[model samples]
Target: MNRRLPTKTIALLLAAALLTGCGAFSNDNRVDPELSLEQAKQTAMAMELELAEMIPDENVASVDQSQTGVLLSCDDKRGYQWTGGMNIVVQGDLDPAALVDAIIDRYSTQELYTAKSSPTPDGGPGAHVIGQHGAGYLVNQSPDRTAIEILSFSPCFVLPEGTSPRGNF
Candidate 1:
């Protein structure tokens, strides 16, 4: 039984075994398969509302929360995660620099998130806040600085076993 197999055959077999064992080609990205779909949705919604409240009521124009089961894009990852997000727009005769400072302060004070500001190199619109469980917010302004846009979103995640998705499309 000391016969040596061809190198190519051995390599192919090794590759196949590695792929099968590691799930390298598997489409599911359920890093935490124990997480339930309802739990994920609840986290996303809670974070979305918490972020929305950070803005001053006077500056809020509207808040639109995304529906449940929003598909995660990237054809390969379509069914792996869902979208939980809220979009808000602010418009008025306001000082954006001051608003930005205020927002950053709010994020910093919040126990749920650690805040940071990422301003554009040329001082354009670019800033965000990162929170627990991939929850976060982004703040951007129109080129003309007439309107400021805000978005808060939950982290895309998969549900646990024994349960199907609400809407994975």
Candidate 2:
């Protein structure tokens, strides 16, 4: 006697094998969204410290942490009198769309700034706000919906005459 597996069972088995092989359910990139605002601030500070290590020559002028976000300002050692600053905003437990919309609404009302919204790679909402100068603001949620980061860079900062800014990106 000969027996054959059912089509539905075969299909389901194949799908399971494929998914396991592809690691489609992996959470390697997932972040814990349960972090409190203070924890997020500490994370931002840790990031700043990492950046400092990356660019040791730059001097950190100030760091400000608040309920909204953390702001870090640095001086480029070139003596060009330019200030480089970055702001990081962390949003926890809010829907991605609502977070992005709030960021857009907050910046849209400001003068000399242009706000544009786009879809993030993970299907989340993102916004980019540009000021009259070279300053820029970026707001986006993580792929895992763990948190949102809003980054802003100052316009006064610029590379020295001979240095290339391309590497900064």
Candidate 3:
């Protein structure tokens, strides 16, 4: 049997349908996974090399590498990725602090498509900071103040400890 619905009932049904179709109204949210800790570190390394290439030969006193790796990884309420990275310290005649700043500035100018910088969680002279675009990259000043540390993934998130990216994160 065919029956006509009341105006109020039909309005309610239409509103419900519109709401469901409108993700704006729905609570459903999705985010792409961030680069693993290892990936983040690698990105940072690449950035370091690229920056080194940019500087005039005479300006750079020296380039040293200490420790480089990913530190932390997590998701947040705002729907953004997060990573904590650490850099290997550097020692040289040039201003270590200035060098690090230059590296970071270049990082912001290039590489990161859309990213913001925040204080490094560990806390140190090495411009510690987190950069995020949808995903996250934990960037740390190298302990030596020469190399930058980028923790692309969380240390805790390991793949059998020894399993490599070929089969691990």
Cα-based lDDT for every prediction: 0.48, 0.37, 0.35
Candidate 2 backbone collisions, by pair: none
Best-performing candidate as measured by TM-score: 1
> Model 3: what TM-score?
0.35
Candidate 2 lDDT (Cα, whole model)? 0.37
Summarize candidate 1's per-residue lDDT along 1-169 as a digit string, tens digits.
1112233423333243233321212232233445445665576667657655656788777666655434332123322334444445565655666656777788788786655565533365444665544444555454444445444334435543455445543
Model 1, position 135, has a per-residue lDDT of 42
lDDT of 2 by residue, 107-160 (tens): 678775555675554456766655432334445544444434434333323234
Question: Which clashing pairs does model 1 show?
Answer: none
* Per-residue lDDT value at 80 in model 2: 14
lDDT, residue 61, candidate 3: 45
Which of 1 and 2 is ahead in TM-score? 1
Q: TM-score, each model? A: 0.54, 0.40, 0.35
Q: Model 2 — which ten-residue stretch has the worst lDDT?
A: 21-30
Q: Residue 83 in model 3: shift from native, Å? A: 6.9
Alpha carbon lDDT at 87, candidate 1: 48
RMSD of each: 16.9, 20.2, 20.7
In model 2, the runs with Cα more than 4 Å from the true position are: 1-92, 156-169
**Candidate 3 segments whose C-alpha is farther than 4 A from its true place:** 1-30, 33-73, 76-91, 111-124, 128-168
